[model samples]
Target: MKQNYIYIILFISFIFVTLYIYSSEIKEPLEDYDETKNPKLVFNGHWSGLFCNINRLVNFLVLYPNTREIDFNVLASKTHHKPFIGENIEIFSKLFQKYKEDIPIDTTYNYDGLDFTKFDLTHRKAYEYYNENRYKLEPYNKAFNKYLHLLPHLQERLDKMVNEMRSDCQQVIGVFVRSNALADEQPTGIMPTREEYLEAISKLDTFSKKTKYFLRIDNEEDYEFYKSKLSPIYETNIKRAKSNKGDAPHASGEYLSLEDLENTYLEIALLSHCDILVHCVSNMASAALYMNMNLVSICVSKPAAQ
Candidate 1:
């Protein structure tokens, strides 16, 4: 009888242990939990540009579906220099609607070093991952559209800017020319040159008087060059880093005014509204594509060796 009791106890203990392990496996592990029952993610910019940071945010949302809120204060405080002054969270709120609740500027939490291998979709490996997953990108795109809504005020501003550009124009050809300091920052031949851009634009039916160009060039010289070549060009009058001595202006370890930041946002926002985009591989271009994947684009690559 005692032997029978011991066997029964052992069987119950095994059952309990199995149940505990299964429940733990099913539950999403989080470092810290809030009252909302979801983990708050802290976005670390790593001194990246605005659109790159935005892309990282979207990628995080897609990969970690359980994240309901994100704090950017940590990024603001930790960077070598404040990229943009003023309320960071408020600026983000003006651009994107609240995903679930108001994204508080919680400084209590820090970036938990989450693996963001999937953040950079521009990488070659990401394309392979997409193909291996049966080429189904609907989920990722859906997450992007769901979380990336421009507030009505910003939307109104964007619409006004685009409408003015579209006025007296039948079509807008968006061009993103990555030049100036980027050539020094990136590996050789990674960034397309002025000749390459012009060659690609030459293939387009841009001779029409009704087609206007919206140039998103980084430097004044290239901007002027493209404007001269591609007549009737429109662009945001934002600050440009004409030097090749260091990083781009926004990421040059200098503090930028809130207005500068807003202009940068508007520039990318405007690029998405274009009927056709002609450009290279860049985060700004990538963000624009994410905004409007259906946009007809002509992506230029470096010339192959002879």
Candidate 2:
């Protein structure tokens, strides 16, 4: 009876050790296998602006290399006010050519069992991810160049605008001013004052009578102000906020038609063609940088603003 009792205890101990090893080692590998084999990221359209959304998409592709596919259907459903169906498809078709048929705006499909990582578009979180993987981000510029391509018609329009500017000016300096209610939307003193922008532009090597300024300001007041200060300013006929009191025309309750969004993108693309860009830290600036990696940028905003 004593020997039998000892044998029973040993058997129980063996079983417990086996279970512990399986839980600690075998189970984790199985989960990792699932993640690596079919990793999917979902975008829920958390951001408002067009470039903000584009930046989020670019961040995901750069940060997560194992991402086999992404679901923009959720983004499409959430962004009814700013419809991203056609433009979003056009953008992603270049990135994921193999999965073209899989990319559609379907909100009803069940994604229950498939484990997915949701992309959060907040600036702080994005920066944190960028810092954590800074060493591996050498491909960031390459990724942007590979993925972000303007539509053919838009590209043609941008070329024509550049040619027109070149005809009149020895150097085309792009100036992006985030004036008006963006200050209210962002932190205090984040937006550079009029004096600061003027000072930055004045310091540029190409600042001369022969240099033309390409303005991308949010409100008409700044538009007129810069046009007065920097003569021969060229701007597209896109909508601008009438006053400094309200949100930007696009961000305000005003309906942003497809043309408005395309014009916004066109402005950014045009900025890429400039000899130098003087701006603050905004999505527009970042998008322009992505479009032209070698474009010289002079940020007049405070360093903390970034």
Candidate 3:
């Protein structure tokens, strides 16, 4: 009886190992597309989720070539909106069903099994448009609205700065201070003095006397002059962003290049990771409001350029 029991145990162990090996060989489906096999579909809706959402949809089309249907209509003006919602999903579904002869995707994508919240357009005219076209616009709008709610919950949603970069042995805090570049350059206004900057920093010192702070600035030379007075633990390259190439309207007469704009985005992401933000009346301050941080945020509202 003992020998028979040992044989049965060994057989069960061998079966389990074989199944594990077989499962390991089964690769996960990658998210990718071959534009040729599945033709490209123009994405018409609000472009916010255009790049990311379309990219994923294309991958689905490629994976299930026979079942996935392409709809260029969603990319049309009739469908796309500044804030996408629900009706768009139904339209997309109908288009897909036309080609596949069956519904391959769920009419609604339940987020973590929870029903998504409806979109609330702050702009009255836009809200009216959505209501009038509810059958055509609801789904896409709902998806985007759901995304807005989920954004604040991400762990690394606010880009990491000093806190995220700190080594296991060292600890630091990253700080972002901003003002409208155009505001100071206007003929009527003047840049604040080093004394003013120091005074503001001193006020914030009550939060942490020992926290190391890294200063980020758009104008490298301007910040250099204040470095000694401000006593920042570290400072990022101002013109370092100039190495990359692209352009955005700049108040300083010259436009910011692609590299410059991208660097600014990265810098903000890191700054938002900080425990606190000391802002002046600048767009960067507006960005901090969007980022949900755990620390107390003390923002100094700067007057708009007169």
Output the TM-score of candidate 1: 0.70
Model 1 worst lDDT run, 10 consecutive residues: 125-134
What is the C-alpha lDDT profile of model 1 across 70-134, one tens digit per residue?
66532442153336764343345435666555555342333422334334454322222221231
Q: Per-residue lDDT of 1-306 in model 2, one digit per residue for the tens?
A: 999999999999999999987654422322333323345555444335556666656665555444555555323222333443343333333222322224333322122111224333223332222212322334556656554456677667778988887777788888888754454332343568899999988887764458888898888888888889987877689888875555566555445555666777778878878878887666667667656655676766553354
TM-scores across all candidates?
Answer: 0.70, 0.66, 0.39
Q: What is the lDDT for 138 in model 1? A: 45
Candidate that beats the other on lDDT, 1 or 2, i.e. the better one = 1
Model 2 poorest ten-residue lDDT run: 107-116
lDDT of 3 by residue, 60-110 (tens): 333334333334344312233212223333223222222323334422111
Go through the candidates in order and give the C-alpha RMSD of each one to the true structure: 8.5, 9.0, 22.5
The candidate that achieves the highest lDDT relative to the unseen native structure: 1
Each model's C-alpha lDDT? 0.63, 0.59, 0.37
Ranking by lDDT: 1, 2, 3
Model 1 regions lying over 4 Å from their true place: 1-44, 65-74, 77-82, 86-94, 101-114, 122-140, 183-189, 207-209, 243-247, 251-253, 303-306
